[model samples]
Structure formats: structure tokens, C-alpha cells
Target: MSTDLLQARDLTIRGEGVTIAPFSCSLGPGDRLTLLGETGSGKSLIAQAIMGTLPKGLCAQGRLVIDGEAFDAADSTSRRALWGRRLALLPQEPWHALDPTMRAVSQVAESHRHVAGRDRRAAFQAAWSDLTELGLAEAGSKLPGELSGGMAQRVAFAAASAGGAPIVIADEPTKGLDAPRRDAVVELLARTPEAAGALLTITHDIDVARRLGGEVVILRQGQVVERGPAQQVLTDPQSEYGQRLLAAEPSRWPLPKPLGERQAPVISASGLAKTRGGRELFRDLSLTIVPGEIVGVVGPSGCGKSTLGDMLLGVTRADNGEIDRAQGHTLGFQKLYQDPPAAFSPHWRLSRLLDDLVRRHRLDRAAIPPLMARLGLDENLLGRRPGEISGGELQRFAILRVLLLEPCFLFADEPTSRLDPITQRQTLELLVELARERHCGVMLVSHDPALIERICDKRISLEATPSVAKRELDPVMA
Candidate 1:
């Protein structure tokens, strides 16, 4: 008889400032289940609960059985023993699971040697093979710090499967990867356990859920609002919360109507070509954005979309291209970077940085509170540093800062990727509305086809380069 690998009965998880109400589920052999929800919706928390790795100040109640053994959240000794041998997790944040000082190869190799009891030399060889499978063989020697965000994520995933554990759990496995990498990761996980298909994924990306093809449990504010086959749940969620979430899917959202009679081009590029690491991302690409125009640059990961943003802002020089900037612009270009936490100084208080933007740009301080509230931010967070807040909160703050600048051109690179679904829609809409009010030209870079369709006036696609195969784009149009 097939036995359940992991089971959580009437699980309730809560932390200092968060709560996850009663939710229940089970994962057995050949079971492919995805726990789906937005950021802070307790998706990660549930995974941590099963692994007995809940964060400090957080507690879990009710029954959890792992591999036919009762699990204890605070039993450090057994937890270490169980990891990689019986249970392995790919944490959402790569840095959280990776050791900064250790070389990437050694760390992943440790999993093979320690958990699986492989010979020392054999473990090292197997580690390389694992990295190769993930398309990260060249990065094996590099430390986690040396890798990019997406590379680190891939490495962490490689480590998760190091011991050939029967049950694998990955949290937001596709978070930083581009479309090609995302699809590759999904394929690798789908073939997990030698095709037995015992994999559990926790993520907010609905498209990812559909691709994985399994049972889905839709979570909201820590509650199980709906559950069913992945296709049905994603395609036609019955509950109100489920309906709202699906409605907010970027593909389903309605695109804003055109801004009739666009003004003269605020920025124009001609013959733009950039090469990075001996690979051409896009060659001879040209685009122009008029005042109030929202031009979305769409492409798979590593397709030079962000590089194009740099070229437009005159930050990174294109190998062969010229960009014309409007003359005497009141405010120049400003960027909402892909990663908000990295953009701010760790040493600076949030309030101090915000204050500087307000004073420098002569922004109306009175409008700050309301804006922060709308973004679901707590004003008390202003006293803390960027490291003190979550990525979602920091992203909202980053957007608020750019709005204060009131720049003539806004380079928003996946600004809402970290936000929850509702907030994603609200934030993007607010950005476009503010841009229209200021007649700003926006260059939005993203891998989300739904988002590009909903907000962009002109869609510019960065064709696939040799480094990344598979053009996972919506219909190709100039």
C-alpha cells in the first residue's frame, strides 16, 4: 500500500504579525500538489511548518506527519537529520538557503555526501552532474554571492534534489528565472523522483500552477479558500477570493484604452544593439515612446530587457545605438529596479531616504501618508532600514519614491513581481495614472505577457539570444 509522505491535519500557523488559519492537506507518493497564494498569504509558512523550520517568533499547531514519523518544529537535532535524507526544500529566497562563505559546488555536494551517504569523490562528481542538469555547471565554482539572482535560485534548486529524496518541496521555484529558465525548472521538477512525480510546489504564480498540472489549494490570508484540480481551480475558481485572484490574472485584466493623439517622442532609440558575456541579446532594435506612452519591453529572462532599460536611461551604453533625450526636461529619468531591497542603502533609515526624496524633489509631504496607506504599508516602517521590511513593502516604498521624483520617463522593471495579485493591479494602474498625469513615458520591462497586454501601448519584444533558447512570448508583433 502507498503511504503518505507528508500530512498536515487542521494546521494553524501564526507569527508575531501574521496569522495562517486552519488549513489541511496531504502529499503521498505520485502526488503533485501546489499550494498557491500571494505574498504573505502563508504559503511559505505552511511549507516551513512541514519541514519544522518555521521562522523565529512563529508557531504551528495541530498534527504534522512526515515520512510516517511525527514532526516536531523545534527539534533541531532530528530536523537536521531529516533534511536532504527524507525531506528537502527549495526555499523561496536563495540566500536564505545558501551559505554565503561556501563555494556553490561544495555546498550542493555536501547534500549528496551527507544525506545520501555517497562516497566523497562520488558525491563531488554527482554534484557537478546535478548542476549540469540545472544548466548551472559553470557556476559551480562560484560562491553564492558571485551569482545573479536567477542563478542563485537555480543552484538552490539543484541542492534541493541532491540526495534523491522521494518527496521534494519547492517554494516559488521560478521566482527570479526568466521564462525559458522557468519552464526548464518546471520540467526538471516534473520528472522528479525518477518519474514518480512526488513534488510539492508553493507559489503565487498561477501560470506556474497550470504548467505543473496537479491538485491546487488556493490560500488567502492563511485560509484554504478553494481546492481542486489545477486546471479547474486556475481556470474557473468558484469562491469569491478565488474568483478575485483569477480575475486579477494579468491576462484576464482589461487593458487601459489608448491615450489618443500622443505627443512628440519623449525618448527615441535607433540601431540599439547590446552584447553581454559574448552573446548578443538584441541587435539593431529601435523604439520610441511619446509623452504619456507606456511602452512595455517583453522577453524571456536574460533577453536584454533590463539592458534595454539601461540604454534608454543612458546608464548602460549600447554597443551600437543612439538615444535622443528631450531637451530641457523638468525631471529626467528614474528607475524602479527589479529588486527593491538591493536598490536602497542598508545603512540608511527608510524615513531618512524618503525625506530626502521629498525635500529634493519638493514633493508634497501631505500626500505621502495616503499613498503609503493605499500601498498597504505601515507608517511605522519608515523608521526602519530597507532590510527590516519585506520585499513587497520595500517595492511599494520604491514606487512611492519614484512618484515623488515625478520624472519625465519612468523605467519600471518588474516593479509588481513581488506584490500580491490585488496590489499588483492597483500599483500598476496607479503608476500609469500618475504617469499620464505627468505626461511621463514609461518603459516597463517584464516576462509577464498579461501585464504587457494590460498596460502597454506599444509592445517591444526582445528576441531570444543563443544563451536562452525557447521564445516563450505572446504573439510576435513589432
Candidate 2:
């Protein structure tokens, strides 16, 4: 008989007086299981509970057995011993998971030392090979700040897979990755062995689940609403929640009508060029945005989409380019990054941050409460800091703050890249409604084609030019 690698029996967790219902699940050796749910639907909480790191005020009652050994939750020593060696986890946010100050080689090597007892030299050697295998050939020696979102996530995968843990739990491992990179990450995780163990992935992307070939456990609110083969459940779900979750993605929605003749371009770029690391990322690229228009920018990993967005936001300077905006118009930009918590000052409370922005932007105080409510944020949460909230909640607050600015142009870069399906749909709908109401032009940068198709009036794919010397081609669409 095949032995079960991980098993959770009658697991129930409580946080702040709210209880997640009792649930049971098991994973056999070499098995793959997926936990699907909306944002804040107890999926991640379940993973944390299993890891024995449930936050303060949260209580758990369950029997967690891993690799023939029963977990003793009350014993911190035993938990730590088993955490990275016997069982490893890849968190939802790679930016937060990695230490910003440390180099990639050091981080991955540290995992080896803690888990496998490798020496510094051996750890570095192993990390380099692992990173190469994960398609991050030059990832080592670079700090987390230097890597792009996709590259950072790949490094996190390499670290998690090192030391040969018996069980690996990945929460949204593909977050912030483009389509090709997403596929590559999923494929690598599915094929990588974990010291002869099993894999449990928590994600809302049905396509990812199907690619990994896992048994699906759909959670709604705080309970498992359905369980079946990943393909079967995704193709023909039985539960209403499952159906709704599948239907939430706008790619499945009908395409929007094309724009008719417009009076004037809201924003325009000419002869745009950005250079980094002595290399031309993009050259002579130009685009135009009209009022009520949503233009999506998409490309493969390392194609300079974020660089362009940063240039537009005035966060980064372009090597050569001329950008024009309508006079007397403020740029209302809200970016829902792959990791929202990392974007804000951790020392400040949410209320203080919002209040400061409101005061500076001269927004009406009366509009705050209703905006929070519209975004599904509680008014009471204003007092809480970003660390106290989930990623989805923080993203909502960020977007709401931008909405309050009421700028003529909005730049949203991967706003829903880290969100679950339900939250992704809700955020997109909210953006559409707000843009229409304010007559704003939105430039959305994303790697997901489905997202581009859903909300964008037009889409452009950016490619890195062969070199900066070729200026005759005129990369901009003037």
C-alpha cells in the first residue's frame, strides 16, 4: 500500500473569533493536490495553519501528519526542525519571501545550510545549479531588488526545491509571471521531486491546476465546497461557487466594442527609448491614449513593460523620448503590484497613509467611507497597518486611494497579477466603472492576455530591439 505523505484530519482554525470549518484531506507520495478559493477565503490561512505559524489570536484544532510522523503544533522546536527540511513552502509573494538586503545566492545557500547542513561553498554551488535549472542562469549574486518580479519568483522556486524536502506547498507560485514564464514555473514545480514526497498547491487559476494535474478542493468562504479531479471540476463544476469562480475571468466574457472616432489623444509618446545596464531595452517606441480608452501593454518576461510603466509614472527616466500630457491634468496612477504590502511603508497604519494622501490630494473626506465600502474594505480597517491585512485588501486600498485622486490618466501595472480569480474580476470591473465615470484613460500593463482582452480597448506587444543603433525603423506608431 502507498503511504500518505501528508494528511490533515478534522482541521479547524479560528482567527479573531471567526472559525474556518473542519476539513480533512490527504496527499499520497508523488501526488499533487490543489486548494482553490477566492481571496481571503481561508485557503492561505489553511496553509499557514499547517505550517504551524498561524498568527496571534488564531487557534487551530487538527491532526497534521507528514511523512508518517504526527506534527506537534504546540512544540515550536519540532515544527522548526521539520519546516524547511522535511516540508517546504513557497509563499504567494516572492518579493516578501526573499530578504531584500541579501543576494540571491546567499538566500538560496542559507536555505541549504538550514535544511541540508551544507557548507557555505557547497551551498553556493548547489544554489547556482538549482537557479540555472529553474531558467535563472545569472540569478545568483544579485540582490532581490535587482531581479524582476518573474525572476524573483523563479529564485524563490529554486530555494524551495533545494534541500529535497519531502513535501512542498506552493501558494500562487505563478503570481506576477507572464504566460510563458507561468507555464515554465508550473512545469518545473510539477516535475521537480521533493525527496520522494508530494506537492500541494493553493491557487485559483484553473488553467494552472489542469497543467499540474492535481485533485481539486474548492473552498468557499471557510469551507470546502467541492472536491474532484482538477480537469473535471474545472470543466464542469458542480458547486455554484465553483461555477462562479470559473465564470469570473473576463477572458471568457465577450469582447468589448471597438472605439469610434475620437476628438483628441489624451496622452502621447514619441521616440521613446529606455536603456538599462548598458543595453537598450526598448527604442523609438511610441503610443497614444485617448479619453475613455484602456490600452494594454504585454510582452514576454524581461521585455521592458514595467520599465515603460515606470517611465510613464516619472519614477524612472527614459534615456531618450518625449512624452506629452494634457496641461492642468494630474496623473492619477494606482499600481496594484504583485505584492502590495511591499509597496507601502510598513511602519504606517492604513488610515494614516490614506488620510495623508487624501489631505495632500485635497479629496473630500466624505468620499472615503463609501469608497472603502465599494472596495469591500471595512471602515474599521483604516486603523490597521498593511501588515495586518491580506494582499487583496491592501490592493483594494491602493486602488481606492488612486481613484480618490481623480486624475485624467491612470496607469495600472499588473493590478490583479497576484489576486485570485474572484478578486481579479471584481477589481477589473471596478476599474472599468471608475474609468467610465471619470472619463479617464487607463494604460494597463500585464502579462496575462486574458486580462488584456477583458478591459483594454487596444493591446500592444512590446519587443526589445536588436540594438539602440537602429533608429530608421521608427519603433513608435506615430
Candidate 3:
């Protein structure tokens, strides 16, 4: 007799050395619930449990009701029939959700055709329309591998929601999006509830939850710390963790100290040009990075921010420009990926991978423990595989690995996008400190302009056209 579209009664999750205590919540028609928390705080796990997609070795318990049908949470397969018909999930990592071999439009069309019960032609048309609305008109024909991280995210969203499920779950839905695109995504999510459907969103961005303006549940270390209306909880959070999370926004962060003196340039490039998908991304770009300096990159999604970094690191060739690295430092250039799990072997434990790197490069084993402590990583996390740990932890681990080689230049591609505000602040502060200490030049990429403004000494702003500009802060500001 309950009118709720979905309900969880004392749902709990268990895994090796981890336990998400009993929690209960529900969503009715036109309802929205957001799980707000730090990385590794069980936000994604809760979403996985609801979607019946928890990774191996993790088990869920308690009762779940979906579309008036009751099922035991432990039997994940019991809800298979409801997938795409009554429930849909947009995973945090779009790469995992999208097929690498399939074109963006085709994947979305598949969902519309099969799950939404539309005809083939109608599905294809709908798919194209979806891509166009998401500002990906040209990306429809590109395979998942060809798209940028933000482009791939939009594709995945189109595919997941094409089914028209009454209940939707989105995890970190706006993680790597710029302000305009991020607002668009939020509008899309808001529309679901407006159309009399139910929505559940998981995110670490406080602004995202505030914009959604629904019920908010704060979790920490696998436990519910607080729950209330979004306006009340976000504006006047009672829990101590909630206040810290809100305070850690980039806008509230303290400005970093200016560099002491200009050092020799670590890398220099001139007249860089690149084109992708038959569109001119950027041309005639030039920049210089000095040791102990942080240069930030900001542009719309798919505007070639990552591509420019690759050009400088020699991972990708520029069509018409030349890159010059400091002499004798060719081996010292490194990169930290946007998705940390993609960079490591999922089957190997973190310790084994670190050991291999140390052995291969003749790095000092003693430096590992201190760096781990400084990064706020627990030693026990090293025992688990990359897929077993949270994204933020893996990213920190990636930084630790890169620092071990004593790199002179680093390309950090949205390194903190997956982290919570508190963790993001902490990680970036540590990265800046280490960059200054080791005199390493870091090119930081981020979707948030405020973040780049706070931490970067210089910034490169890319536009849709071939024009680009590199802004250098004054000595006092830098």
C-alpha cells in the first residue's frame, strides 16, 4: 500500500575490513535524495547496493522495495528485471559504464530501443537529439575511447537515462564539468523529479546538493552522520563533518604563498597546434613553466586541456610546435591521470605495484612510509587492489608514486576531481607544498575556475576557436 517508488529498510553492506551500518530511506514520486560525503565514506557503495551492482566481495543485507515489489537486498539478482525499466544507474566512472568499442550515439540508441521500447529509427533519432542537447553534436560518431572525460560522461548520462526509468541514481554526476555544463546536468537531473520520477544523486560537491534542493543524507566512514532537507542541512549543518565539508569549498580556501623567485623554466613550448574529430581545438599556443610553479589550465570540456598537457609531456605530438625540456631532465617528466584506476592493474595489490615501480626505477623504499603518512593514507590500504579502494585514495597513491621518481615536471589531469572538498583541499595543498619543496613544475587541470584561480601562478585559457591566451600573474600575486 506504500506509495513510495523505492524504499530501503535497514540496508547494510559488508566487505573485508569494511561495514556500512544499517540505514533506511525512501523516495516517492517526484522525490530526490542526495548522498553527500567524502571519498571512501560509502557514498558510492550505497548507490551500488541500491543498483545491485556492488563489486565482488561486498555484500548487501536488509529489505528493498522497488516499484511496489519487495526483495531481499542480499539477493542482488532479484532486481534484475527492474533495471532500465523501473530503475537506472549512472555510474561515477563513465568509462566503466560505456562500451569502448561503440560509438556514443549507438550506445544511447541501444538503451532507447531496447529498454525504452522504441523503434530502431526512432531510437537513433532520439539518441542524436540527446547528444545535441548535451552539447555533443559532433561527438555522436566518436567511440568512447575518442571522447574526453567530460564528453564521455555526457554520453553515459544520455545512455543511462534513455530508458526513461522512473527511478534514477547518479553518482558524482557533475564531477568533471565546467560551470555552464555542470548547471545543464543539474537541470537535467532536476527535470526527472519534475516529471513525476524519483532521483537519487551521490556527490561531494556542496553546490550540487544545494542546487538539487531535495533531501540530503550525509555519510562518513560507512555511517550516516546527518539527514535533513537540503536547504536546512547545507546552509546550517549541525554535524561537525558537514560544516567542514562546506567550509572546504575552493572559494573559501586561503590563497597560496607567492613563489620566492623565478627559477629556470622546466618546460617551454611555442606555436602548439592540435586538431581532433575534424575540429580545430587550439593553435599558436605558447607557455613556459618554471620549477616550483603551478600553472593551471581551464577551458570547457573537450577543449583540449588534456591534449595540451600530453603535448608538453611528449605523450602526444603537436602538429606545428616544438617543446623544450630542461636538459638532463627528460626522464623526470610525469603525469597523473584523471581516472586513477585506469592507470593501475586491477588485479595487483597496491603494495605489489609500488614495489614493482621501486624495483624497476631503483627508488628508495624508505620514502614510501613518510609520503603515505603525509598524504593521510593508511598503510592497510596498500594491501588492497586498485579497484578495491576509493578513487581519492588511488589518486593520492598515484601522486606518491610520481613523487618517488623525483620528477622535475608533472601534468596532473584533474587530479582532485574525484575527491571530496576536504580531501581536495588537503591534497592540493600537499601537492603545492611538495612542488615547492622539490622545485617541481606542475601543470594542474581543473573544471572549476575558482580552484585554478586560488592555487595557480599562471593560467592558460583555451577557447572554442583557434585563439588562446596564457595569463601570467604579477610577481606579488604569483
The residue-by-residue lDDT of candidate 1 on 85-195, one tens digit each, is 778898776776789899888988998898888989999999999888877877898998767667788888888788877778888788767778899999888876345
Q: Each model's TM-score, in the order given?
A: 0.84, 0.91, 0.96
Q: Pick the candidate with the highest TM-score.
A: 3
What are the per-residue Cα lDDT tens digits for candidate 2 across 249-358?
Answer: 75786665555566476678888988776667788777787777778887766677788777776778888988887776754544445457667888888889988887
Best-first order by lDDT: 3, 1, 2
Give per-residue lDDT, candidate 3, residue 140: 98
Clashes of 2: 1
Which model is ahead, 2 or 3, in terms of lDDT? 3
lDDT of 3 by residue, 1-478 (tens): 9999989999999987678999899999999999988888888888788888887789999999888999899998888888888999987888878988899999999999999999999999999999999999999999987888888889999999999999999989997888888999999999889999999999888899999988999999889999999999999999999999899999998876787799889999988889986778887788888999998888888888999899999989898888999989745899998877678998999999999999998889999999999998889888889877777788899989999999999999999998999999999999999999999999999988789888988888776565453433332144
Runs of candidate 2 with Cα error greater than 4 angstroms are 72-78, 192-195, 258-263, 330-334, 380-383, 464-478
All-Cα superposition RMSD per candidate = 4.0, 3.3, 1.8
Q: Which lDDT values do the candidates have, in the order given?
A: 0.78, 0.76, 0.89
* Candidate 1 residue pairs in backbone clash: none
TM-score of 1: 0.84
